[model samples]
Target: MNALPNIVDSETGQGLPRYDLRVENHGPSDLEFEIWQIPYNGTPDVKKPLRISGLRGRNLALIEHRVLRLLAKAGIHLGGLNIQDQARYALNEDQALNLGLLFRTLAPMRNRENMPMVADGIEAMGKEEAAYWLGMAMHRKYPRRVLMALRFLLIDPKARMKD
Candidate 1:
């Protein structure tokens, strides 16, 4: 498990749950990766949503993967991710929301490298709403970039740059 530090929500006065990046080997060549939320008491939260879009089992991996990709495409490359290794980092809600907002305005054009001429239909979206769009992008599998986006979301703004 690769853990990231917890950040407190300013309004709630409660720290958010720590998150860890985990990868499971499902087959000889198939690897599944996910971001697991670790609440206080140092235990992993195992409550998987019963249903997502009528799908029996769906996880945060899909949306998170897209988020990472969107950030990367926007020229904010949070590097040093190794699919075979596990490491810890730190990320807060504000950071996530900011990244989402960045993607919202600069979201790439449909199935092409260029961006839209005008930011149409783009509005301020909270984290949950942003997540919904991420899932929708994953579900529709459109824009081509969504599916082709990176499959990891391991980023730490505080980490020291490696030489």
Candidate 2:
């Protein structure tokens, strides 16, 4: 396995920053994962962390939308304590740490981009439209925080059980 890259402070761009996880291939087989950088407070310096994990071979596009719905119902903020608690409850220690890192990176960028809800009335979304736009905005500004928020949101019982 290759040495994991050092987690850097997003704002100062300094080294020796502490992140939730530093992903590296543990096995000989090749693995693919996505990395998102989430910012906080609209400042490039105060980032959360990096999330690195293996995909479960599911349809991520669909999962992403479902997760958005969960977030909307939960009323959980990206970097809020509720989200952190949820991450702890839903994921294992390592997963939670990874998620925490991701949240730090993504939360700051939430809603930074403008994604119109309606465009020519062509039935723009099937589900979780608002969440999708929010995620997109998060991705543009802070990719990691958005993922962390989504991770917890998807597994949050209160968020999912709502009508």
Candidate 3:
């Protein structure tokens, strides 16, 4: 069975997730990319690890939106946690790391060359790139920290729960 590329610890030889991303010209100056979520041996640089080349796309809006909804839903499941803990957990570095990992698994997509979302005629995106845009959009609209996002999501997990 095929697996994503990852780096393993040199000492332990234990494999771990590692990302390899690239953005460059694909056609006549239009940008494209090659991205991988490697499950490599401890030392990716030193080890000749296998890699998986994920599909490329012009945008990740759909996947990101879906992921955010899913994340909020998962958090909502843990209703036992108080608001303070829930909000705090949302901002925790470890949570961010896990989210970062999740970002690598999404497939890429495309858009019209002149569409408002992306008129640049781009052809690819890294798994989490859409999440970056989503974050920026959220910040632009709300302009706050984790607790605010947490509160918003918890109050209505269905708010952003798009299919």
- Best candidate (score: lDDT): 1
Model 2, runs deviating above 4 Å: 1-27, 33-139, 157-163
Q: How well is each residue in 1-163 modelled by candidate 1, as lDDT tens digits?
A: 4334456667877656444333343434333433334455333343541111110012222234554564455444435544454433333443343343334324332422122111112223457755655455445746345423321121222332441
The estimated TM-scores of all candidates read 0.32, 0.19, 0.25
Off by over 4 Å in 3: 1-19, 28-30, 36-49, 52-55, 60-103, 108-156, 160-163
The local lDDT score (0 to 100) that residue 24 gets in candidate 2 is 31
Predicted candidate 2 versus true structure: per-residue lDDT over 19-85, tens digit per residue: 2222233233321223333343333575554443322122222233433343345442233333113
Which rank order by lDDT, best down to worst? 1, 3, 2
Ranking by TM-score: 1, 3, 2
lDDT (10s digit) by residue, model 3, range 55-105: 234344344344345447545232343322312122222333334332323
- Using TM-score as the measure, which candidate wins? 1
TM-score of 1: 0.32
Poorest stretch of ten by lDDT in candidate 3: 114-123
Off by over 4 Å in 1: 1-6, 22-33, 41-78, 81-83, 94-124, 130-163
